[model samples]
Target: MSVHIAAQIKRVGRTLTANRAFLECITGVWLLTAATHHYIMAPASVLSQVATDLHITSGVAVWLVSAVPASWAVTNFALGVWIDRLGDYRMIALGVGTVILTGVWSWWAARQGVFSSLLGSRLVAGVAVGVIWTASVNLIGGAVSDINRATAIGVFITSAPAGFALGQLSTPVIASWIGWPASFLVMSGAAGLAFALITDSVRHLAIDPTTNTASMRANFTAVLQHRAVWYGCAMAFAAYSYYLFMNSWMPTYLGQRFALSAALSGGLAAVFPAMGVLSRVGSGLISDRLLGQRRVPVLQAAFLISLPLIVLIAWTRWLALIVTALIVAGFVIQLTFGVVYSYVREVVEADITGTALAFLTTAGISGAFSAPVITGALIEWTGAYLPAFTYAAVLTAIGLLLSWVAPESPHSMN
Candidate 1:
């Protein structure tokens, strides 16, 4: 019996080491996938072209971009519940396969000159993204230990903004040269490589079963009853509202308000996500260094600082002021993601961590999904960007208040 206990301890140590290595590789692939999806299929590039071809207004064209997050909101909840049962590798494999198939379909549809088929292809990609995002984050949280968890999660989540930034940087170039369809083909090939890497690395890990009906229900109930989970969800929702607004509408705002060309607007938009990637890493390091300190204050400080910057970017016409505001907003908004993830994980049990993450993701996706449609309507109604920016700013302030009110879980460094 003593020998068995000793062997189990050694095995756990080995698993921890393997998990860290696996997370490193997984984060790289995740960044690739995120950058491609955000930039290639993003509303700014693909939807703009498709809208022009279809003779639709910008308001309607925005749906193509909005559909991805909206679909993700619904699908992520289901996928989150099932990820443990399917195992991380299998789920990732399925997600990659879906991306590959959809990429080819997207390319073919673009070639066929059929707008509806292309839209269908984008929706298919959205489904895959929903599953991929949820499973990947959960996988990282499950595999890593508490001590290094925030840093690992910070690296992984930074991919979200980094991917968006890369998309902004590359989309215009790809669209101008080979055209958008060809760009997706390139992305498909990349997804294939990522799939191969993830599968190879995680093949030996244990797969948990999802068939335990009662336990699943109990887990959901427990998460629902947990205040920390709700607070995390609220924070994510507010942060995503800011992120989606920048991602979906910033280029159009530049084009409409500033009279910039698509290429130039895209270039400017790239800076926001680039700053976001850096901020994510910085915030995680801060959280790690201040572990057991007052993290809620740190979160509130970021929110309060970012609100005015976002408003300034939205309202200003000066090129220098606009650019500076965007850079600061990106840094501030993107950093909140890792902090929220760390907070939730600290509060939840390791066994049900995936479930907790799914709830937070759902809230974030809901915010992201709503931003485009609502912002489109706001623009349609007000004929100005001020109201939309104001709405986001107010939400950020509310998020700050919520952070203060939320009870810090025992898991916090404080």
Candidate 2:
């Protein structure tokens, strides 16, 4: 009897370890994909090339950058409903395949010198990215034990900014060396490799059980009626406002305002995201430790700190001060999501976790999508980035005000 009990404990321990390893592997793949999608294939590198080749202004080139987020937002709403039914592995495979094909198409478009075709390929790539990112987040969150869920999510979320940082740092160098078309081909190949790895590892994992009619109706009804859902959506918008603006506009701002080179601008833009990667994990760990206490205060603190930094970055002309302000703003703005996700999971039902996360992501993406256009318009109107930066600071302040109103999870309190 004693021997049997000891063996059982060992088996359980091995299973837990395997589960953790699996989650980590997926997280790594997701991070790489995100990095490639946002930084490498992102509009910034493409915008410069397309604008130069087509003799267009940066404002028009902004569409190439903005289209991906717009498509992502639309696809996420539809994809979220069907992702669980199709299975995580199937969704990943499909999403990766789509992205790979889009990369090939983008290369072809670039070679053919057809501007519209290149834009079309980007939009298609955006749709695939939307499916992959949303599914990956929900799948990883579901796979882990509740006790470790926040930590897993934190790690997963960190990959995105890490990827963005890497993308920003690498894209310009690659583009400078081989040009944009070849750079996109390399990204496509990487996506294909990630697809193969994830598909092989996830093959044996159990599929999420199909939703029944009653549960489906209940989930739809619950999400629609829940005030927490609205709050979560709002929080996502608030948290991502700064991220969108900084990631989309900051590189250009630095280049134009401070007379930095493309490589230098891209490199500097990476600092905030790199710092954000650490802050994201730290915030998650902090939230997990304080699960028994209050979550609102931590979230409130992140938002409040973000406001002053954004203001400083916008209002100050000093290069040293602007860099410092951007770094601080990046840390606080990116850190808020860790707490937001934890709060959402604690309040929402387990069955609809994907939908809940999808809604939040959609809101955030909306903010990201709209931010560039707004900033562009502001620049066109006022001929300066300060007004746009100031606008971002106001958005953060409003988000902080909303964070106070977000409902605390009853489960978290316990």
Task: Give the 10-residue window scoring lowest on summed lDDT in candidate 2.
Answer: 205-214
What TM-score, over all chains together, does every model reach?
A: 0.85, 0.88
- For every candidate, C-alpha RMSD to the true structure in Å: 4.0, 3.0
Candidate 1 C-alpha lDDT tens digits along 320-398 = 8888888888888877886787777668765566677778888998998887678878988999888888878888888
Q: How does candidate 2 score on lDDT?
A: 0.72
TM-score of 1: 0.85
How high is the CA lDDT of each candidate model?
0.72, 0.72
Total backbone clashes of candidate 1, pairs 3 or more residues apart or in separate chains = 5
- Candidate 2 lDDT by residue in tens digits, 17-73: 667557645655664466455533354655667688766787677677667778888
The local lDDT score (0 to 100) that residue 198 gets in candidate 2 is 68
Candidate 1 Cα outliers beyond 4 Å, as residue runs = 1-20, 35-43, 46-48, 52-60, 176-178, 203-216, 252-266, 293-295, 314-319
